[model samples]
Target chain A: MKSKCSRENKRKLENKLFKASSLTLTLISFFTVIMIFTILLVQSKPLIMKKPLSEFLTVEWAPHLGKYGLATFMASTLFTTAIAMAISIPPCILTAIYLAEFSTPKVKEYAKSMIDLLAGIPSVVYGLWGVIFIVPIVRDRVAPPISEALGFIPVFSAQNNSGYSVIASGMVLAIMVTPIIVSVSYEVITYVPFEYREASLALGSTKWEAVKKVVLREAAPGIAAAVVLGFCRAFGETMAVLMVAGCVAKTPTSIFDPCYPLTALIANNYGEMLSIPEWVAALSVAGLILMLIVLVFNVVARIVVIRTAGE
Target chain B: MDKRKIEEKIFKYLMISSTAAIIGTLALIIGSVIVKGAAEVSVNTFINDDVALFPGEEHGILHAIIGSLYLAINSTVISFLISFPVAIYSVEYMKKKSLSPALTISIETLMGVPSIVFGMFGLFVFVLVLTRGFTLLAGTLTLALLELPLMERGIEEVVRMVPVSLKEASYALGATTFETIKNIVLKQALPGIVTVSLISFGRGIGEAAPVMLTAGFNPFPPASLLEPAASLPLAVYTYLSAPGQQGKAYASAFTLTIIVLIISLISRYVSKRFTRYVSR
Candidate 1:
């Protein structure tokens, strides 16, 4: 009887210990995030305090001239992300629709795996491919014809047609984010109730019409969330963009002109900036800005997803 | 013949073309890597350590390959230790129902934070504040942070899939909650845990930016956790930047691709086997 009582006490103690440890581990997620944010804010304090907000928002980025403006990098980041979204969203949606509605079971299985494989390819591999294949294609094949036909437009007005431009980086970013958007949108589209499709089809609608009107509308919020997620991804992509975006720290005036996104700027210059006064802190500020933008996108996307899921 | 029919046909064609484009792009990337990388593949490329130094000269990435594997395995193990417990707590112990949602959102946000930003965080916290220099340990910890969300999510999904009846049976048998979790939940989720670990390993090996900042690059093999080490992605990035090292870059990319593909295939196979066993 005494031994049985001792065993019970030991079991209870172990259970409590395990529970406490697990709870602590769970809190580490929150702890790590707050720590990262605090560290970035602290590290960037020198730059934030020294430079006026107005100067930081100006278009000039010549740090050598006492101008530590980040407007150029911010503009390029937005421009590339916008261009990437424009090129990628329609195709990604269509692909998602096909995977969810049109493809056969066998086709879906293989195609889904293929997309997963695409997603798993390392960013550096993408960078290498971008440099070797996509760069030349953009310079030799796509740019020349576009420049010839649309040279009157300022966005296509660069005369030299070097492969390293906003368009090249944008295209690469588009490809990188396609699998992410397609997979998420596919999940959302597949979750729509079959009764909606049935009701539309019973009303003399064709298959495409049913999917377009019923399924797509029901999945709209989820698709928007997916696009936002993709945007967050494209905005923060570094190595591939650094490899192909020409690393020019100027606001791009045209799609054909070279520009540097914030990520590319940090990745290329972080190591070298350690010795330069205020440069490391400036880069820390950029990092803080990137984290904030991504956090905002994530929060908005999660709210959209959760609200729709609840409904 | 009607307007509706024309619109439907156009939409169908558009979807088909989009699918074609996605698959075609995948083919183009893999095909180009294979084609260009074939010329540079040789015995020397896999064995020599001076690959980064000589650029276009005779060289290899053996040191980087080994270093990447070492880091990947170590980080994955460390992350699993932390994330597995968090998964169990969120599923089994947390009282407030709202806390789970908040936790999930926070983890997703962490996952979405850019790799370069994580590099900067590591630079400040691990390298600068803690270790006071770039080292393999700092890089491993940074990658562990990066892998935590994915590992936790993977384990949570698998644990949640465990049938309620199993736990009920354990409770009826007079097992303590911790005992039930150890013998019942974890045993059943073993395959899933393995799969998640391997996936994390693959992610760690492929990451470049975080490691580049926290783990100082060295051409020579690392002698200890505090020593600087090279990684496959960093090697590839460096080679791509040098004007004459294009061939070496392609070779390193091909090597990295093969390693990533193998890891992915093994994980897929393990999951497939697990499903088969469960169905049986």
Candidate 2:
């Protein structure tokens, strides 16, 4: 009877221990989020307090001149991400459609695995590929032809033919994000009910018409979520963009001109900034902005996902 | 009828071509990396530590390879320990009440935060404030944070996949809840947990930005967790950008790619095998 009582006490103790440990682990996420905000705010306080916020809104980013305006970097980030989104969305949607509605099981399996592998490739590898292959291709083959034909346009009027421009980085970003967009959209599209397709077909619509008119409409919100996720991914990408985007800290006048996005700016300059007065603080504020932007994107994406998944 | 037929045909062709384009791009990226890197791969590249300093001299990334393994293994182990418990708590202990949706949202948000931002956070908090300098421990902790969401979500899915009947059977035999979870639930989820850890390992190894900030650049292998270390991705980044070191960069990238690819392939294989087991 005494041994049985001891065993019961031991079991109870183990249960309490496991529960306490698990609860502590679960709270770590909360702790991390709080810690990140605190650290960023603390580090950025120096710059935020001394510099008028208006100074940061200017177009130039010459740190040596005490001008830390983020206009150029913001424009560069938006421009490159816009180009990437424009180029990647159509192909990604089509691929998702093919995977969800059309491909044979064997073909889908192989294609899906390939896409996963593509997604798994490290960003540095992508950057290296951009340096070696994409940059040269853009410089030698794509840019010259475009410049010759459309030189009248301000965006194509650059005399220099260096491939490291906003467009090349955008293209690399497109390649980097295509798999993500395709996979997420594919999941959303596949979740769509088969009965919707059947009803459309039964009502005399073709498979293409059903997919276009009914299925696509139903899955539009989830697809939008996927695009937003892709945008977030492209916006924060550093290494590949830094390698191919020419790292110029100016507002790009043309697609052919070099540019610097917020991420590339931070990655390329953070090391040297530590020694410069107020530079580290300025960089921390930029990091804070980037984090907030990504946070908003993620929150919106989550809401859309939950609503869609709940349905 | 003819218009509809043409529209269908056009759409089909577009989808086929787009799918083909995706595959083509993947093939092109991997193929080019292999072809360019093959020339630079040599026995010396694996053994020489001064590869990054010399433009054309015989050198290798031995230090970087070891450092990467050390970082990846340490971070994965730490992340697993933290994430596993959280997964079990949220999935099993909560018992259908489900942890607050807010917690899930926050975890997802953290996952979406830019890695560069994480690097900055690590730089400010760990590197500067806590450690007072770049160190391997700072990088490892930052990486553990990065892997937390991925590992937690993965283990949650795995635990949820554990059939309820097994737990019920254990309880019906007079097992306590903790006893049932420790034996029946975890035992069934072991393969999936392993798969999740390996996937996180791959992610931790491939990450460069966070490591670059928290772990200062050092060509030599680290002697302790407090010392600075060179990671494969950081090495690749440095070498690739350095003038005249392009060969060494390609070689390092090739090595990194092979390691990442192997981890991914193994994880996929394990998941596939376990999925079969579960279905059976």
Candidate 3:
């Protein structure tokens, strides 16, 4: 009787210990984002103190002259991501619609597997492919034709026909993010109730009309969320973009011009900038900016996705 | 009516063609890697460690393959250790707590943070402060942190799917909450846990940005966690920049791709088995 009682007491003690330990672990996990934000802010404080924050946003980025302007990098980042979205959204949405509404089970299965394979490929491999295949295509085939046909437009004219240009980065990013957008949109589209589709068809509407008016309308917000997620991924991407973006610290005047992005700025300089503390801090500030942008977009996207999923 | 018919036909064809184009792009990407990598990937590519510097010199990526597997396994293990506990606490303890929303948001935010930003964090915390330099420990810790939220979310989803009846049954038999979790919840969630682990491992193996920031390059095989290591993705990146190393780069990419392919297939197989078991 004594032994049994002691054993019971030990089990109860173990349970209490388990609860406390796990709660502590949970709290730590919960605070990681805040920790990261604080670390970035503290590390970048030195740079922020030496020079005003506004100076960092100026057009020049020559660290030697103490000029830390990031406008050019910011513009390039935005341009490339915008181009990626413009290129990817149309076909991604169409593919999602096909998989959800049209494809038979076997075909759907195969398509999903293919998408997973695409998603599974590393960024470096994509960069390799971009260098070998996409770069030449853009340099020789895509950019020259566009430049010749649309030279009047500032964005289309080629100042330099280097294969590593904004278009190359955008094209690589579009391919990289396609699987994400497609999968998310497919899920959202499939979640629309079958009854909604049945009712639309019963009204004697054609299949495309039913889909256009009803299904697309219902899944619009979710699709927007998916696109935002893709945008965040493309913006945050470092290696693949770094490898192909030509890393020239200039604001690109044309899609065929080489430009630097914020990610590339951080990645390209981290190793060599160690001797200069101020430069290191400046890079930290760049990282802080990147984190803030991604965090805001990610939160918005998550909220939309959660709300749609809940409904 | 005539216009509507034509519109429907046009859109149907458009959707089909767009999907075909997407698939074709994927095929071309994979086909290019395979075609190019085949020439450079041989048995020596796995056994030898020295990358050929000059013509007719012997070369291999054995160190990178070994390093990648080491980092992925160690990081996944570390992540699983922390994530499993947090997941259990959330599902079992914090389900009704007001902190649930905060936890969810934190996890999602962590998930959405770019890998590059994580690289910055890893550089700050591990490379600069703790490890004092690029080491396997720094790389592993950084990756573990990156994988933490992903593993937690995946595990939590699976644990929540565990039927309440089993827990109640355990409690009825006088099992403690901890015991119930260990024997009943975890047992039921094994396949899902494995699947998530595999996915996280694959992510760790394929990730280059964070690893590049934390894991300094080493040409030789790592002898200890304190030593710098080579990884396949980073190796690919480095080799691509070398004048005559493009062949090595393609081969490294091919090996990494094959590793990821195998992992995904295994995870799919595990999940399929899980669903079948549940149905039966």
* Strongest candidate by lDDT: 3
lDDT-better candidate, 1 vs 3: 3
lDDT by residue (B211-236, candidate 3, tens digit) is: 98999888888999988999999999
Query: What are the per-residue Cα lDDT tens digits for candidate 1 across A112-226?
Result: 9999989998888888888888889899888888888988998887765789989989999999999889998998898898899999999999989999899999999999999
The residue pairs found clashing in candidate 2 are B45-B60
Q: What does TM-score give for chain A of every model?
A: 0.95, 0.96, 0.97
Clashing pairs in 3: none
Reference-based lDDT, each prediction = 0.87, 0.87, 0.90
Candidate 1: residue A311 lDDT (0-100): 67
Better of 1 and 2 by DockQ: 1
Cand. 3 Cα-lDDT: 0.90
Question: Candidate 2 on A1-311: residue-level lDDT in tens?
Answer: 99999999999899889988888888887567767877888888888899898877788777777778898898999999999999999999999999999999999999999999898888988988998898898889888888889989989866666889989999999999998899989988988898999999999998999999999999999999999999999998888888899988878978888889999889988789988758887788788888889789978987896787678
Worst 10 residues of 3 chain A by lDDT: A272-281
* Top-down lDDT ranking: 3, 2, 1
Among all windows of 10 consecutive residues in model 1 chain A, the one with the lowest summed lDDT is: A59-68
- Global CA lDDT computed for model 1: 0.87
Model 2 C-alpha lDDT per residue in residues B96-155, reported as the tens digit of each score: 464557667778888888999889988887898788889999999889998998998899
Compare the candidates by DockQ and give the number of the best one: 3
Clashes of each: 0, 1, 0
Q: Estimate each model's TM-score.
A: 0.96, 0.97, 0.97
